[model samples]
Target: MNYLELYILAAFFVTTYGNFLDVSVWEDNPEECGRTRFENTTLDVADYSKARVGQFPWVAMIGSIHPDNQILFFCGGSLISKSYVISEAQCGRLGQLVRLGSIKAEDTEEEKDCDECGECALPPQDIKVRKQIFGNDCSLNSVQRIIILELEKPAEYNDFVRPICIPTDAFCHTSRIRQRALTPGFGHIFSTLVGVTERKEKFDDMRYVNSAIVTQEECNAIYPDLLKDGEFCVDYPKGVNHSCVGDTGGPLVEYLKVKGVARAFLIGVAKINPLICEAEDTAPIVYSSVCNYSEWISNQIVSSIEAERKQGRRLFAV
Candidate 1:
């Protein structure tokens, strides 16, 4: 090929796929976590409906495999690292398989292709749970309902599967209060009454809702007994209901600019609410504060790696 022709071809390639190439530098660096490879340029963050593929790559579906080989997903969680997922204690007993990289709730195929742009995602990962570590104050009555699930192997990173950043000191102090955040999950989308039977329709696709942070005093007025020191609440927009059944243990994320790049941070985990789907409008959702448990999370991960090394097993090298 002539030099002039080669230069033209290279320019066309850069113009068409420059954004994808720009983020490749962070693909292997654990320190540069929480950035999505595929940017959702179409949808606005204020949209409170179905989420676009590759928008929130760290959202995980926690489920169990039955003896008949059927998977029953009952909860949601966030992938904090290649080897660990942060969830609630209630989900610790329920999670046998942690699914990542796909938005579909039930699909036979290993990989999902985006219909909008004709881009194909890597195969979805169904990693086994090697261990379940509960928080120090985890209990039925306590608001500290945190649990960290250790995956049997490190999840391979791709355009659709990556880790969300843990909250930094600055993020916790500045961005977590009186600010709107996002909660994503693959849960019940809606319900209907057929004759006498009220049937709740499970969502086939993942969805997200934008909600505002509720102050402790405001949340206490609603559930005084349930609101505790290490917990916070978020209220959905008017006429919008979210964080329903099967969403427990999912993440409440806050987006902020880090070094001129937009990034997401894990701020809260969805705490189980009995009236989640029942009260459509007025119910404020509670979440376990990830900021308060940051130290505990770090300590557990360090100890878990040590324990695994003693037995000749190496966890994901994050």
Candidate 2:
């Protein structure tokens, strides 16, 4: 179906069924279906730098409870629907919340400093994560380790907040390989090639690095045990750019031309790699293939909604 039709259908399902929202309806739409674009916008994926304020509305900053009784930007995540945020199994805990609509402030190290960064302020909706499911089991570094978080309430769609499209299995397995994609996150920004010159301070905006998908053979050589079925690898261009500590669980999205329109698709989830920040050209960065676990994600969302309906209250799955 077309973009408009898909949106209407999705709304209808939520209204009529009140629990079961068809995940495939929007999945079939163009990748740019729910994004907010402005005229005269210029994006440079090659150089790789901080993103515009609202350039990626579907991106969310995950906040997990710390031992000090404060919330922190534990990891990155992507908003897949009004009620779910797709993240990595190890990145977020079950009781944490995800922040949307605003960019993370630059040069902010603590939560107090974030509150003063006016434009980077968070949205009012504090959607608590009601349930967290990592496919069949919480196996780290695997596609099955995708964490599907059910928000306590449905997020309101707007210019500053939106959702990205999840591709079908065919699209991920056949089409996305060997394609150029953007990996955005709040990771560390290294000045020189050595250690982090600007460490601990978060960027004022989302940082994006361009990467090209590589064949499984190339990645398999580096990660013999980690590279498995339903997982893919990307190669960072010859440069000093790559994902850092805070980038894991973030979206690895690719833009495609659908009927003369540029659309975005969530192809994979960024896996943790301490060595990748300094790794250069042809260095393979692994990601959990999103398309491979599409079935498990949809099933979890549907099942969570059904459970919430039956219980007549919110439920948190351990």
Strongest candidate by lDDT: 1
What lDDT score belongs to each candidate, Candidate 1 first? 0.69, 0.63
Q: Per-residue lDDT of 109-203 in model 2, one digit per residue for the tens?
A: 34421223243434434567766776665654344657887787778767667787777654655666667777777773221123223333446
Model 2 is weakest, by summed lDDT over 10 consecutive residues, at 188-197
Q: Tell me the TM-score of model 2.
A: 0.75
Give the least accurate 10-residue stretch of model 1, judged by summed lDDT.
190-199
Write one digit per residue (lDDT tens) for candidate 1, span 116-217: 456666678899998899866656655557889999887887778888878745556665567877778876222111111121555677877777788888
- Per TM-score, the best of the predicted structures is 1
Q: Can you tell me which runs of candidate 2 are displaced by over 4 Å?
A: 1-33, 39-44, 67-69, 105-125, 139-143, 188-204, 243-246, 278-282, 314-318
Evaluated against the true structure, the overall lDDT of model 1 is 0.69
